[model samples]
Target: MTAFHTDDPQPKPFRVADRLREAREAAGQQQKALAALLAWDPAKLSKTESGTRTAITEADVRAWADATGMSDEDRDETLEILAHFKVNEKSWRDRMRHGRRSVQLQYNELYRKSVRFRIFQTVWVPGILQTPGYARQVFTDLNELDPDTPRDVEADIRTRMARRDHLYDSNKSFEVILTEAVIRTLLVEPPTMLAQLVRLEDLLDLPNVRLGIIPQGRRVRTAPQSSFVMYDDLAIVEGFVIDNPYQGAQAERFAALMERFWADAVEGPEARQLLRQAITDLPK
Candidate 1:
């Protein structure tokens, strides 16, 4: 028996990965032998199995399905696992490669598949409603000091702009809450920040999108800093490091958090009025 370490505290994906590994072992193949069959480095197989690294290409999943002689039903189940794996892979790539520019696209795809989405943002605007220039400025500010700077800047901007299409699309329901500070923060120049504020106003009109702003002066009762999103179909909580696309408990906690925030959210004419006031206060 080969021993492996996993960082997952919940153990759902790790169990699924273990099942796939067991199937290979049942067929009397070693990790090296299986990697050779899939044309992947043996270490890649080990890292994936160990949950240290997760980036499964669709091709890799299909190969595993075929190699393991998975039934039609099982293959579909395996593909779901692959989808989760791929999402995590893309996330890690975005963080590490710094050139990868599709986090918003990936989030949108997940949103489309999700019946409900709950999001919280503390700094700057949420990606779904950010104007292109504002997004560029935000990404530029965040990444400028890094060596990867200019090359990654444009790609990140494009990716964020592309994600905005989901705001207008009616297929999925989105619930988003932003801290009042996000509105006041000047990630971009004055003109661009004004554009972003206007964009948020436009987004509030969308039937499918629910916008909430937590006043900077408002009382804070619960958790104070981190932001997260919860998808309905699957309970996944995405963070800066790991994407747990299948954690049921974490999903429930965030869903409850969303409800708490939404209940406390100021909406309708009053909300719009507050937004207007925030825009007026923007530095000229």
Candidate 2:
């Protein structure tokens, strides 16, 4: 495991550092004095002010506020800012209540802006790569889960197909890992599934796209967790009821997930062979 990275300017500027420094200065305390109060190295405080120490925890933030004599309101506001740097979670149930199209739009924007994507799926093809027939089946199944929710399955399919536009951008890259279980699962009709497999085979040949399959029975770094999407430095982990975005140490954990993906996955000709075999196995 590596230490948290604070030197990168990604995810935007470290506003927490600036806020802490301003709070300390407003309290009329020097960095050395604040460090002494918090029993931390003066360099720790200085580096944090300079945006090179972003791994500070909530407890550290609270301690700094309390030690610096910040007003309660100011401290709470600071903590709120720090919370964003940590993680943001939303219940999938609530998200779906507004209809699946909204969720699709959210990802549409995310896909539009991202330059690189690291995706892992344990039981289904990743959405962006799904064929129209396959994606329609998926949306239909989702609608079945909650018939009361308003759904325009056709519109949803169009949005999903639009997301695939990013796949052809030479400046963009994608690395996807799918478990063997996902390949064998028959979610759609045999013809639709076979077509989806054909799409995967073509995607595998793209210079900027890499597809890997973790064959069954292979040892891996960790048990498969829920499928998730890693967009640049941000990681969006899908849970049973919620989708969680992890940053800081939590986001760094995706590195381990990536390792698990590559360690057990077969790529290049091996992946192509597996996909072709799957297509052949589809019902006649």
Q: Number of clashing residue pairs in every model?
A: 0, 0
How many residue pairs in model 2 have overlapping backbones? 0
Per-residue lDDT tens digits for candidate 2, residues 1-284, read 11223321123225788888888988899888889989999898888888766576789888988988878898888788777655421233355566778778877887888888899888879999999999998888877855766888988999889999899999889999999888789999999998899899999878999899998876787788689888877787753323556776887899678876798899999999999888888888
Whole-model alpha-carbon lDDT for candidate 2: 0.79
Clashing residue pairs for model 1: none
Point out the worst 10-residue segment of candidate 1 by lDDT: 1-10
- In model 1, the Cα lDDT at residue 6 comes to 23
TM-scores, each model vs. reference: 0.61, 0.66
Model 2: runs farther than 4 Å from truth? 1-98, 239-241
Each model's lDDT comes to 0.66, 0.79
Candidate 2 pairs with clashing backbones: none
